[model samples]
Target: MTDQTVPRKPPRRARGEGTVYWDKRLERFVATRIVGYDDRGKEIRKRGSGKSRSAAMEALRLRVRDYERGLAPGADKTTVSDVVKDWILYGQGQVDDNTVKTREFNCAHIDAGIGDVLLRKLTTKHVEKLLRSMVATHSTRTIADVRACLNSAIKRAMARDLVDRNVVELVVTPRGTTGRKSKSLTERQALEVLTLTKAHWMYAYIVVSMLVGIRTEEMRALTWDRVDLDSEPATVAVWRSVRKSGDTKTRKSRRTLAMPDLAVDVLRRRRRDQDADRVKAGADWKDTGLVFTTTLGTALDSANVRRGFRSALGAVPSVNPAEWTPRELRHSFVSLMSAGGAAVEEIAHVVGHSDTSTTERIYRHELRPVIQTGATFMNRFAAVDVVAPDWHMEPLFRLPGEERTAHA
Candidate 1:
């Protein structure tokens, strides 16, 4: 009989190539690879199990690839919470306390949604789903902040080879709940607020904010050394803020603004009141040198300011304290300037915006739709009989003889 060639058994896999076999008891395929040696020189193996041999081999290949790419043997087990907590703990360096707090708050939302998801198994779909779930209760800005926090956390993970990619970067942010709109007080309402709160502690804060348009942060950080009430046309330096760097929000924000008579008057009275408070507190006074302070002479925080502001507003029957924030005083300043026919460019400079575009964009609701400067110039050139509004004839600072000089 002609000798039938027997098929030789398939060559055994080389060492470290790994092994795949059907588990007779479990009735499923399993794969294992020698990833490394333990501290005791024992073999350290990584395993993957699946219903099919190909699936098991694929799972094993992924683990091996991660190990070769410098990831730890159990890198696939790292979860979203692990990465986020790590980043929140260590990734924020030299940042403001407020910035760190904001990241922690935003990251908490991420952990609540997908904290248990494995980093290796995370995908764009997972991130998108998490964002979509937030649409009902969170604002678009809040949603965006959450996504940014996750993206940063994932990037940190990738640096450590815990993840291969940042799936959050690939996901598109979805629309979220409508946020509360910012509003400005009308001139009459602003006057009412000022008059009603005159005897209250927030009087000077309200006057300076509404008239000079200094930010709440800047107002909180104002110091005695920066005020120049003794000089002609008194000024206040807006060179610092409560930010960690102690710099103004922008380079343009580091300007010295001439205080209106109203602002100077209120600030003077506030200084006297603070002196009285210092005597009252005696040794308890902290002497922080801030323009606004608590009873103990400590700096005014947002909570303290808000509580006082609301209590002051309670005296004004026409104005609702619940609907307004201290920041609205700055908005009211913009509105009054625009209504008084100040050019957008001039208002931009006073508000420390780099350009008119920013001023117009942020204060669009407060700005007039027309170009008033061109019309005013044309009216003057033609010697038109058209009368201007009372505010148009009045200077913002209302300095002595300014109105007469403007008319002349």
Candidate 2:
């Protein structure tokens, strides 16, 4: 009893060899393995812990498998929130600032829902639940975007072998709240909207949007240099948008559209009006070169354009300002053109869509399919409502005792 040296608990398992132990303090079983070394030559080990022995063993097995596959041990503890933040930082210069801002918003929403979940443990059920939770509060498009953002983030994590699979892709996004469908004005309504908004400063904006079909972002970012009024057929170069990088939505969106007479006239008048404002503002003018601007001449933001559009809508009695958005003008343009018998291809070309499928999908209600004479053949039968019953039919040939006079 005098020399009882507590047999040093079987010298802790050697490095690189994995081990499992019960942690009294954590009240859990932990599995650990030596992963590698940091750049500073320090040992980088991975730890997996769970309340149950089997759970800890399974986690440890995953850790060892991932390490053998040359994945970073640091990823074992990485959370969805951590991945999202890393992706945001890594993606800064890859996309436009507006896109980055939108991604950040989407990620913030994702974080609020399931950000605390570990990347390794993220599941399809977790993502589906997140989307369903958002259905009541966010638009379907917004929920779709959130899914896209998280999918992209998890994909990046996968590329780094931080996670095994992208659970976001496995889940079908739930149907979200119904959003306002895009609608076009009737021809009479279109004429009224144009006539009513004519006296406002944003009159040209409405006219060009309706007549030329320029996107709101493209119009807001339009510069004097891109507008050509003196050319035999006036045109506006549809090449830019208010995106921080000044890129159009797509390469096909970088197009030159011929202006309608109404568009040309309105644009010319706007040039003169802007010139006058420039003189009035003098040194205070921002000189942003944007086609749309505030009184001080700085570029108009979406809010400014939206407020002006609603104000313009105030002029029409039948239309509610709250019911319409600026983008609807472009929709109205497609509808009006389709109603006027414009070809789908022509409409798509003018709208800067990459293909007719996009134009058709978006404006299906406005488009009429080409049919020749099927209606003519179908219409005659629609009037045969008074067919005589077989019982009421006269005999095809009269018997010998039938009345003689044809007039009778």
Candidate 3:
């Protein structure tokens, strides 16, 4: 019998070298490269394909370069969804509960749009498109928050060597829908609101907020120990808040504010009301020590305060209850104090701002009119004063020996 020599397929390329072949099934050229080895000594292959051999070779070179740079190991299989999940898992303990919830909400938008894209393949165009989609239906603030979340998530991924770079940072965020500006009630409107809330359960809350300008979180977290009603000047120490950490928004925000007579009276009444509630609740009361509490003495949250505020506004006829918020009470406080001629520095101190710039920026509308009071005061002594009955003025350029005289 004649031994027929069998034709064999070409030997496989060496370890470091790559190979190119025509893919009959896809009718395209395919390139495969051995880029590196894993810790377990398994060969890591980087693969690419294109319609032409040159295109496939170019793609292979790019993939090998990405591997050499440690750009997202196995990125062809790793989607943006995977990277975002990794980031969230690693960051679970870094932020507050509210911030985590906000991040989660933001991530929902990212996942809905481009989460399926490969992490290393993500580009500025993808991020920009996501932001534009958000702008179409969301407010500027909301869109900005989404952008921030994606940026932070991708930044962490890059730090972990899961991505070459954060493409979200390269995208220019589009302008989104403008949100409602903060506003305060007029003097007459404020008085009406105060009068209407007199018999409501949130009377002291509304009164102290309007008078002291404390944040709702500060007010809700206020405790009896922090309030000094027996002192020469009744005061409330804004040392804590209803935040998960129980800390104020900033060091400046943790302050002591002297109570106006209205606030003092309202607080005294609220103290008595709370005592009655405690007696009624008996063992059922939570005893959280919060100044603002429900019938069971549990601390009030933002939703609780918002609902109560809107209910109180129902008593006033001229104001649209839906348009106003609890925060407007603080805005109204700034307005009232400005109208009463309180200096900007004094207002900033009372509201616990670190500096006047914050007060100016946030309460510019509520600030007293900058009507050139300096000009008016200086005009009183000016030689060209329009209101002066006498019109005589003397020139100060007389010679050394010349007698000085007033000129009319």
Candidate 4:
């Protein structure tokens, strides 16, 4: 009798473990799994294809894991671009229009670098590579903003479970190209600018900004109601700004500044000029009640202020309009105050900084290199002992324990 050979049966896969089959047409292994039941009680299936059975099974495992974590079908295919665009469209709420535009512009850099990359597959290496590439052309601030944009977008994705973690947060920001440093006008240049821009439409805006150091946004948002020109000391409230919230940038920024003679005079002239503008505009005036406005009484946007500022500065032969911005006027204020021996604390208060450190850090270039307060106070005592070369009179104050004159 011939010995019978028993054929072994293939091992059976556990229920819901999925099945792998070789496709003759595609010459590849494909894996399929029933991820869920549809609304109609039919199996909702997901498929993963690979060149080999193990590869196909591994791919299907990733899909099943993502689905089990509560991610919707097709979540594995979501791209970084999709996540950023979704965040830009829906996550930001009640931000300024300019802020929205700025984020959109910054996100473009990310999109160009790795926007199409799958969100689930994003890694710290990918983000670091993208930022390092930008280091050559973008400023440090710009690079930082781009990283922040990516971080925020990933956070939004994580909140929705589109990403397991934020790869951007793990990547360190690379040092980027140095940008142009802010500069201030010298005393001579400030005088020239003031004299030259006297007849310009932005004269009051220029005067108030340079002399009082109010931010451009605050200057634009100033209104007649906030002006107290009739008080003992003329004052302007720095209580509002052109931001989306219409509030000051910080709690310290909401201060009531005593206007100088120059600012008070300029604002009076501005009010008179605005009345004339309102008369000329007739029915077209929008009555926005903004201290700075166009002929039609509408609020002046940043673009309008920038263009007018450049035009006004163009009249100054010493100033290059293209090289200067309106914000530099505030820098000039800090420079002049520091040069005139004003304390950093005083300058900080005038500029409405949250603290003196902020003023010192940002305006360090404008501050006096040598601390003169102590030296200045000590000089008074030194001068009391040293008689002038041409001295011919008695000392103003009697020295301690000095003998009285016989004539007394």
| Top lDDT hit | 4
| lDDT, candidate 4, 261-369, per-residue tens | 9888989999999999999989998988888999999889889999999999989999889999999999999998888878888999999999999998888878874
Model 1 per-residue lDDT tens digits across residues 1-408: 769988997578887679999899888899998989989999978778789978998888888788778786668789999999999999997678989999999999899999999989998888999999999999999999999999999998988888777889888889998887778998888889888889898899999999999999999999989999989899999999998889888899999999899999999999999999999999999989989999899999889989888889999998889888989899999999988978888899999999989998888888874676787888787654544344344545766655455553
User: What Cα-based lDDT does every candidate model obtain?
Assistant: 0.89, 0.85, 0.85, 0.89
Query: Looking at model 3, which ten-residue stretch has the lowest summed lDDT?
Result: 383-392
Which residue runs of candidate 1 sit more than 4 Å off their true CA positions? Answer: 1-56, 67-74, 95-99, 373-408
Candidate 3 residue-wise lDDT, 1-408, digit = tens: 669988998677666658889999999999998777899999989888999877987889877887787776566577888877776778666356778888888899999999999887888888888899877689888898888878888877778777777778777778898777878999999999888879889889999999899988788889999999988799888898777788887788888888989899888999999999999999999988877899999988888999999988889998988898899899999999999888898899889899999999999989985556788888776646566676666766877898876555
Score candidate 3 by TM-score against the native.
0.79
TM-score of each: 0.78, 0.78, 0.79, 0.81
Runs of candidate 3 with Cα error greater than 4 angstroms are 1-63, 92-98, 369-373, 376-407
State residue 97's C-alpha deviation in candidate 4, in Å: 1.8
Q: List the residue pairs that clash in candidate 4.
A: none
Regarding lDDT, does 1 or 2 come out ahead? 1
- What is the alpha-carbon lDDT for the whole of candidate 2? 0.85
Better of 2 and 3 by TM-score: 3
What is the overall TM-score of model 4 with all chains considered together? 0.81
Output the better candidate (3/4) by lDDT: 4
RMSD of each candidate?
Answer: 11.3, 6.4, 6.3, 7.9
The TM-score between candidate 2 and the true structure equals: 0.78
Two-way lDDT contest, 1 vs 3, winner:
1
